[model samples]
Target: MTVFLIRRLMQAVVVLFVMSLIVFIGVYAIGNPIDILISPEADQIERERAIEALGLHLPMWEQYLVFLQRAVTGDLGRSFAFSTPALELIVERMPATLELAIAAMGISILVGIPLGMWAGFRPESLAGRAIMAGSILGFSLPTFWVGLMLIMVFAVHLGWLPSTGRGETVEFLGLQVSIFTLDGWSHLLLPAFNLALFKMALVIRLTRAGMRENLLMDYVKFARAKGLSTGRVIFVHVMKNIMIPVVTILGLELGSVIAFAVVTETIFAWPGMGKLIIDSINQLDRPVIVAYLLITVSMFIIINLVVDILYSVLDPRVRLKEMKS
Candidate 1:
């Protein structure tokens, strides 16, 4: 376990380095922020001063080295647009994004797994076919479009739920979240459902596939031969084996949910990191953009590490394989 963790940590460091280089270079090529930062009529000396102050006077490589130095000390520079530390700005909005992502994940897992298990257990049933069809539709629909339709139907016509924004948040454990309040949930349901649909469909498909495969394995047949109750056979014998893959996919997708929630946040006007990054990009705020992307890369790496560790714990074969290596 120690060796495995050490190897993963080393790999994560390399991945972060590569991602930082790519993000810094890519952001630099977007456009000169000096154009937006300084007045067009500013004198040459003033322009040069602004450039130096923003560290644009240095070569890109030197600037990257400076960034790396500061990053090693837990600094990713400040947002040019907001005049705040990049990490601080991202952290402020993180709870909103995190809560939304987690809510979406909850919906996906809670609803998708049961439906998928039932569909797999009774593939020939009418309800099973319907569930499969719904999953396909869930995958096919665009998130933004679905969000709009939901707003139009629920908010405009029925007036059942709020159309946009994170509503009525109460602070819990130093983070403001809406999950605890009824009014807050009314605001969350639409966007969370919109964000969850595709992932939910994915979970459904993954669970169904695993269920079908495990059901046909020799152990399943042996359990049946022991005259175990059908419910016990399916839930205990089949579900346990199927969970290994299901858990892996869900763990990785959790990172994606937080990282790529831009469209849903945009449509819903949610005050999350996704919206912040969009605005930063539009304003050519290199620090925030770079910081956000690098942080997102770090998140994926961390989640992958967690999933790998969970993989070993869930299946002893993985630990054995790693030890042999």
Candidate 2:
């Protein structure tokens, strides 16, 4: 297990290194920030000073080295647009994004699994068919569109929820979180639901498929033949077996949810990392852009590593295979 973890950690380091190079080069290629930062009528001397200040005059390799060095020290540099530490800005917004992602995933898991289990057990029933049909619609709808419709119905028409922003927040453990406050939760509901729709559908389908497969396995029959209660057989025996895939998907999807919540955040004007990154992009804020990308890549790598570790824990077969390798 230790050897396997070390191997995975090494692989994660390599992946992050490659990802940083791609992000740095890609951000540089987009367009010089100096063009947007300075007035068009700015003279050559002014342009040169700005370029020098930003280290743009250095060779690409040298700039990358400087960036890498600073990054290693947790200094991601300051945002050109905000003139603030890029990491600080991102950290400030992280809570909202995290809250949204967690809420969305919670919705997916809580609602999807039970419905999927029911559908898998009773595929021919009316309720099961309805759940399947709803899952299809969830997949078909776009997040932004769904967000808008939600805002229209819940905020504009019914006036039950706020349409935008993280509402009232309370400081918990030195971080401001909205989940504890009524106003905050009301504001959170629409965006979280919209963000969760597709993932919910995906979970439903995956769970249903897993359940159907597990239900037919010999152990299930054996459990039944042993006179175990149907509920115990299905919930304990089937659920444990089916959860391997669900947990894998959930881990990976959590990363994606955080990364891809940009659209939903934008639509809802949520004060999160996604919204901040979008603003940074428009202003050509390379520091923030690079920081965000690197952070995102790191998150993905970490989540995947966690998922791999979880696989071994959930299934002894996986642990044995890793040990053998």
Model 2: how far is 225 from its true place, Å? Answer: 0.7
Clashing pairs in 2: none
lDDT of 2 by residue, 42-87 (tens): 9999999988988889988899999999988999988998889999
Q: Each model's C-alpha lDDT? A: 0.91, 0.91
* Candidate 1 per-residue lDDT over residues 27-131, each given as its tens digit: 999999989878899999999998888999999999999999999999999888888999999999999899889999999999999999998988889998999
| Model 1 residue pairs with clashes | none
Error of 1 at 270 (Å): 0.6
TM-score of each: 0.96, 0.96
Stretches of candidate 2 above 4 Å error? Answer: 320-325
